[model samples]
Target: MSAQSLRHQLLTADKPGRADLLFGYLRAHGNKHYEEEGTQMQHALQCAALATRGRESATLVAAALFHDIGHMLADDPVEANNPTLKDDLHEELGANYLKGIFPEAVLQPIQLHVAAKRYLCTLKPAYYEQLSEASQKSFRLQGGPMSEQEIAAFEQHPFHKAAVKLRGWDDQAKDVNVEHLEIDAFRASVLEALS
Candidate 1:
């Protein structure tokens, strides 16, 4: 199917259909390895599973699932191997692409997830130390943590806490061996959050 048609379908699809399209997309493009993790799809599933296990709202769980989808849009060979090789700003890209399909509750976390990473680096001195090597590299490209002023501004956003939580999930989602729900498992939650 064409890109336009897929977008329209994703935006207009019922819960199950939308989930299918998302799954198809991930199955096709999500094959790319994400740093040390197995693949992009694996990471997404792990993130969503983490949110589910944490008993987060559907919006946050969906946000966790789609957070890095922007990366799927690009076929950057170097980036697939070296995260710091490129900064595609996947957060903004994914949020913009998903805006028409989901509500602010879902979109905001995807948009701010990167900022959440930067914010965490600022709030916890040891936080930066815990990041994976690929994460550490991307952290530099993402502005190498936030300044105090930036941190204050980030914390003031309505979804600030949620985004931070999502970021934590994002970081932990890299474990390849973790058993988690697949994309289709979020069908009900995705349907509810659709705009």
Candidate 2:
């Protein structure tokens, strides 16, 4: 579907239709690579699977599945992997788009996942080295490690811990060999997250 139609669906569709549109959109355009070892669809499914396996809340599982959706929603989705491009602020874009559709339980983690990465890099120095080369490059574009003040504020967010967990899943979700459940597996979680 065209971006215009997708936006229209997101904006005007009923709850169930929104969920269907989301999964359909993912299935369609999610084959695009975004600096990960696997396709965007694979990464999303893997992260959601990790969240499901960990017994996280349904909202959180949905958040994990849709966290990087901002990449897909971008005017140029491939810009995420372009070292020369600036930070796309995809977290904010996604959270903003999803505002009316989902509750904060789902949006907060998506919004803070990037900050969670920055938080992790500071809280655990070794985490920086564990990042993929593309992630490392984006880390620089994403402002590297968080400052002391930033860390302090990040910790105060209600979803900080969830965001941190989502970040861990995000980091590990790039495995090309991992077989993940299909998007249909997350339908319930996605529907539950819908406002």
TM-score of 2: 0.90
Residue 103 in candidate 2 has what lDDT? 94
RMSD for each of the candidates? 4.5, 4.0
Worst 10 residues of 2 by lDDT: 78-87
- Model 2, residue 82: distance off in Å is 22
Please, what are the lDDT tens digits per residue for candidate 1 over residues 134-193? 998998999986888998899899999999999999989888777767677887777777
Question: Model 2, 1-195: lDDT tens per residue?
Answer: 655556556779987899988898788778988876799999999999999999999999999999988887675554334343344688987777677888999999999999999899888879989998998899888998888899999999999999999999999999998877889999988988788
Best by lDDT: 2
- For each candidate, the alpha-carbon lDDT, in order, equals 0.81, 0.86
User: How does each model score on TM-score?
Assistant: 0.89, 0.90
lDDT for model 1 comes to 0.81
